[model samples]
Target: MTLKVTDLCIARGGIPVLTGVNFTLAPGAALILRGPNGSGKTTLLRTLAGLQPPLGGRIEAPPESLVYAGHADGIKQVLSVAENLTFWARVFGRRDIDAALAAFELAPLADRAAGTLSAGQKRRLGLARLLVTGRPVWLLDEPTVSLDAHATALFAAAVRAHLAEGGSALIATHIDLGLAEAAALDVAPLRARAPAPDDFDGVFA
Candidate 1:
C-alpha cells in the first residue's frame, strides 16, 4: 500500500502552518522533505505518521505498517541500549536484535544505559530500533541530527537497502541523506502564520 495525503492543511493556533499539501509515496520510493526551520517539515511528518491530525486532509496508512523516528527517538533513557532495542523488537515482534544492532554499529553500546550514550550514539541506537522492526514505511524527522560522517553514511546505506527491499521513506531533513533516486519535496514555502490556541482543533479536525 502507498501513503497518500490530499488537501492537507495544518495550523498551530489560528495560524496556518501548511496549506494544500499533497503527495503520494509508493513502495520502494523515498521522499526527502527539504524545508527551513518553522516551515512545517516536522508538522507534516508528524501528521503523516498519525501522531497529529490534519486540519483538512485525508491520509491512508495500514495498521502497524508505518514507523516514525524523530529527533526525540522515542527511546527510554532509563533502559540500556540493548534493553531499549529489545523493547522495540518485542513491540514490533521482530525475531532478531543483534543483527539490527550490528547493522547500525550499536553492538558495543548495546548494554550501555541509553542516558549515558552520546547524542550520535543514541541516534544510531534509534535507527537500530527502526531496523529491527522491519516496518514497511519510515517517517524520519532529522534522523541524522547527531550523526557524524561515518554514522551518517551507515544510516544512508541502511535506508538505501530498506528502499531496495520495497520499503518507503519520507524524511524531513535540512541536509542531504545520500539516497539514490530519491525525490526532494520543498516545504519551506508552505510556512505561514503560527496556529492559534483556538486553532488547536484543526490539529485533530
Candidate 2:
C-alpha cells in the first residue's frame, strides 16, 4: 500500500512547526527527509508514526501499517540481543527473528544483554526491530546515530532489501545511507515561519 500525506501540518507543544507537507511513499521505495536541526523532521515523523495526532491534513494508509524507530532505541537493557528482537516480534505477532539478527550482524552477540552492547551495537539492535514489526511503512528518525561506517552500510543494505521486498521507508537523517534509489525530500521549505515577536513573549521570564 502507498503511504500518502496531503497538505499535512505538524506542531510541537501545540505550536505549528511544519505546514503544507505533502508526499507519497509507494511500495519498494524510500524517502529520505532532509533538514537542518530544529526544522521539525522529528516531529513530523512522530506525527506520521502516530506517536502524536496531526494538527491538520490527512495521512492515507492502512491502520497499523507504519512502524517507527526513534533515537531512544526502545530496547530493554536487561534483555539479550536475540531476546529483544523476539520480544518485539511477538508484539507484532511474529515469531521468527533469525533474519533480523543476521541483517544487523547481531547473531554473535545474540546472547549478550542489551545493556552490555556498545553504542553502535545498541543502535543496530534498535533498528533491527523494524524487521520484526512486519509493518509495510517504516518511519525512522536519525537511524544512524552512533553507528560506524560498517554498521551504517549494514543498515543501508537492510533498507535496500526491505525496498526490494515491497516495503517503504521514511527516514530523517543527514547522512547518506548509500541508497541511490531512495528519493530525497527537504523539509526546510515546509518549515513553519517563526512566530512574530510579541511584547508579552518574554512576560513569563
Candidate 3:
C-alpha cells in the first residue's frame, strides 16, 4: 500500500504545530522524519496513523493498513515475552508469532517475564510486535531508544526485510538504520505560525 499526505496540517493541544506538510510513502520504501525536539514529528506521525485527526489537508491510504509504535515500549510487564507476542498477534487476527520472535532475536527471552528484561531487551520485544501486526505501514517514533549498536543493526535488518516484502515505514528516529530505501524529510519549515487573534480552534468547528 502507498500512503500519500498532501497539504497536511497537524496540531498538539489544539494548537497548530505543522502546516503545509506533504509526503508519499510508497510500498517498499521508508521515510525518516527529522526535526528539532519540539518539532511536530510526533504529531505528524500520530495524525498519519489516525490516532488523531489532522487539522487540515489529506492523508490517503487503505483503511486499517497502518500500525504505530511510539516512544514507550508498549509491552505487558506481567506477561512473558512469548505471551506478549501471542497476545498482540491474536489481537491483530494473526496466529503465529515465531517469525516475530526470530526477527528481533527474542526467542531466548520468550519465556522470561517482560518486566525482568533489560531496557534494550524490552525495546527489542516492543519492536518485535511490528512483525506480528500484519499491517503494511509502520509509524515508529524513536524506535531504537534503548538499543545498542548490534540491536540497532538487527532492527535495520528487520526493516529491510519488511521493505523487501512490500511494507512501508515512517520512522521518527535519530539513529541511522542504514536503509538504502530511506528518504529524509525535515519538518522545521512547516512549523505553524502563532494562532490568530480570532482563532477559535477548540471552540469552533
**Relative to the true structure, how large is the alpha-carbon lDDT of every model?**
0.84, 0.92, 0.92
Q: Mind sharing the TM-score for model 2?
A: 0.95
What C-alpha lDDT, on a 0 to 100 scale, does residue 40 get in candidate 2?
A: 94
Question: Model 2 Cα displacement at 24 (Å)?
Answer: 0.5
Candidate 3 lDDT, 1-205, residue by residue in tens:
9999999988898888999999999999999999999899999988888889988999999768999999888899999999999999999999899999998999989999999999999999999999999999999999999999999999999999999999999999877789866999999999988677787865233
- For model 3, the stretches where C-alpha displacement exceeds 4 angstroms are 196-205
For candidate 1, report its TM-score: 0.89
Question: Could you give candidate 1's per-residue lDDT for residues 49-162 as a string of tens digits?
Answer: 777667777888784889998878778999998899889888988767887788788888888999998989888988888888878999999999989999999999888988
Q: Each candidate: how many clashes?
A: 6, 0, 0
Worst 10 residues of 3 by lDDT: 196-205
Could you tell me the lDDT of residue 41 within candidate 2? 96
Candidate 2 residue-wise lDDT, 81-160, digit = tens: 99999999999999999999999999999999999999999999999999999998999999999999999999999999
